[model samples]
Target: DAGITQSPRYKITETGRQVTLMCHQTWSHSYMFWYRQDLGHGLRLIYYSAAADITDKGEVPDGYVVSRSKTENFPLTLESATRSQTSVYFCASSIVISYNEQFFGPGTRLTVL
Candidate 1:
């Protein structure tokens, strides 16, 4: 089965810099989600797309952007990444949110320097 994974397990970036985090899945699930894990955030959704060219903003959509032009790949870009954005980013996919199990990628640790 095709699984999901991420790159640059660790990242050190400064404020006001452009950083792109990559997410790739093999299952070809219809639903893909981007979430940032923080102390109090408890995995707040950044963005989610049901299909290609159809994306909707999630809980905390500010300071980040997502694009899912394809079914197997979704990338997140932080325009002018900020210190507050320093957190572990996780990408997950599932066939359905209500019953299907959500597969989470290894995750990308981004730090603002």
Candidate 2:
């Protein structure tokens, strides 16, 4: 089945350390986004890319970086993992930026101690 996948579904790390969350999509959607889901704050966009080599920051991009060297992959890296940044990260893809059909990966649960 062609869909999106996230590696290391669960991860544990310490503050000040770096952690990278990987996201891959087989559908080849033009738009991809990295979002963090936390309690009280349903979901917050961290970053997004329109195509390969083209990316931009979203609502909450601090302490995070994203790159799309290939259309199939969009990896989110937390340069300095913090306890407050601990949340379930989700990668989603869609044909457009509007409210259209989007496919999401299982999610990566990251815990920072």
Candidate 3:
């Protein structure tokens, strides 16, 4: 099936290490978003891209970076992983931010030590 997908379904890393979570979609959605699901925060947006090479910071962008060099790919990277950063990360895509429904990929569970 052609849909959005996340890589390394689960990840474990130590503090200060750099880790990248990849998201890819075959549908060529116009917008892509990265969110972290935490205990307190329901789902906070980390970053989003309107189109290839056009990215913007969302609600929470600290310690994280995102880039969309291709419409099909949106990767989120942690410059320096921290224990507090460990959470379930979800990647979503939508054709229109206002009306279209967002399709989400299976989350990547990250554990930082």
Work out the TM-score per prediction. Answer: 0.94, 0.97, 0.98
lDDT tens digits by residue: candidate 3, 37-99: 999779999999999999999999999999999999999999999999999999999997898
TM-score of 1: 0.94
Query: Could you say which candidate leads in lDDT?
Result: 3
Error of 3 at 42 (Å): 0.6
Task: Count clashing pairs, candidate 3.
Answer: 0
Better of 2 and 3 by TM-score: 3
Worst 10 residues of 3 by lDDT: 95-104
RMSD of each: 1.1, 0.8, 0.7
The CA root-mean-square deviation of candidate 2, after full C-alpha superposition on the true structure, stands at 0.8
When sorted by TM-score, best at the front, the candidate numbers are 3, 2, 1
lDDT of 1: 0.92
Candidate 3's error at 39, in angstroms? Answer: 1.4
State how far residue 52 of model 2 sits from its true place (Å). Answer: 0.4
Tell me the number of clashing residue pairs for each predicted model.
0, 0, 0
